[model samples]
Target: MRRSAPAPQLAKAGLEVLGEGVADELPSYEQAFKAVVNVEVAPRATVARSAPGASAEADRLWLEHARTAAVIDDEGCFLIRGAGRDWVRVRRTAHTALSAALVPGAGSMVIAMSPDGRRLCALTEEDDDYWIVVHRFEDRP
Candidate 1:
């Protein structure tokens, strides 16, 4: 029997997780905002472009396959959308005052956040497997 080679780790996108309790430190408001924006929005265009008349089931399937994440800001929460490596779109909800911010190559299923709203923990994928990824407002450059 032959064994398969180990999957390669993706490049560090500067949003790598530091560890538990790292989120205790608070980030500046600007930094927090930027982190919230740095996520991908769900790719609705693919379904629209490929099948204008796609059924409800198709929509559900697309969402199931696409990678997703979320982050919170002073205004509200943001939904991040992606496929595997990076985010592509961000959607803002639960707030009327804040507007949506766009950032390329940032997406995952954000599962946790720091009490100070600086650090974020998300579930992302690498080579078809899901893994937890931590992101912080301070990590943004």
Candidate 2:
């Protein structure tokens, strides 16, 4: 009988197949998330809250309270998303480029990059339930 390889190894191989010029060296999830702190969030106007009965003051406060992190993939492109929003893509090689903010909903986001740096994922908790969101680098234009 043939034995299957470990999950981690299989994942790495899959990434290599999908990644764009991905290197053999891949950072672990822990390391990837830790590196997220290094990516900076550009200053922007305060975001407004769309919830019913939410006041402008509440929206301003929520924007201020929102936390953000960025995960740099193996290709040097980074994915950034804040609480209750979709991921934003930015390239390290580019300067003066701005990423648009996405629709929001997930609270207190935690990010992780796939081994080949081809995917960005976020884990969030709401009402004692956890959710995962994934964004593929190749899918972006």
Candidate 3:
């Protein structure tokens, strides 16, 4: 199997990456559930273009403290749609994984921020697999 390259850093966009690895390496379901539970839930605030499938439980938790973002699109595209106008799409590196783990029946790219607004986690789909990328917001002087 061919390993994909590391994802691009999102620091310039105010998100500092803490750590990211394949979700399959996690040891237990309890840990994965804990990570996904921390993310804040809200009703749809912006218009979405496409609806990607949901994520799997095992792939949801990559880090305990790291914030996760999910992007669901039919074309397996990862996008950051903010304010219902600005659209920032990530270039896919790994296969998009839309397991039935987190957010069942969710569509479009999933972007979630940490409660304190200091961190972010992003999920993207590519080549029939889902990819998870995480970052924290850097403080400016």
The model with the greatest lDDT is: 2
- Cα error, residue 65 of model 3, in Å, equals 6.5
TM-score of each: 0.23, 0.23, 0.30
Which prediction has more favorable TM-score, 1 or 3?
3
How high is the lDDT of residue 139 in model 1?
54
* Model 1: lDDT of residue 23: 28
Clashes per candidate, residues 3 or more apart or on different chains: 12, 4, 25
Across 65-121, the per-residue lDDT of candidate 2 in tens digits comes to 222222444454543331223222333332211111112353343454543455554
Number of the candidate with higher lDDT, 1 or 3: 3
Please state every model's RMSD to the true fold in angstroms.
Answer: 15.9, 13.8, 14.7
Tens-place lDDT per residue, model 1, 44-121, is 222221344432333233223222323443333322222332222222222211101111134322333433444554
Candidate 3 RMSD to the correct structure? 14.7
Q: Write the per-residue lDDT of candidate 3 for residues 9-81, one digit (tens) a residue.
A: 3322332222322222222223322333345532212112133422432233422213223322233233332
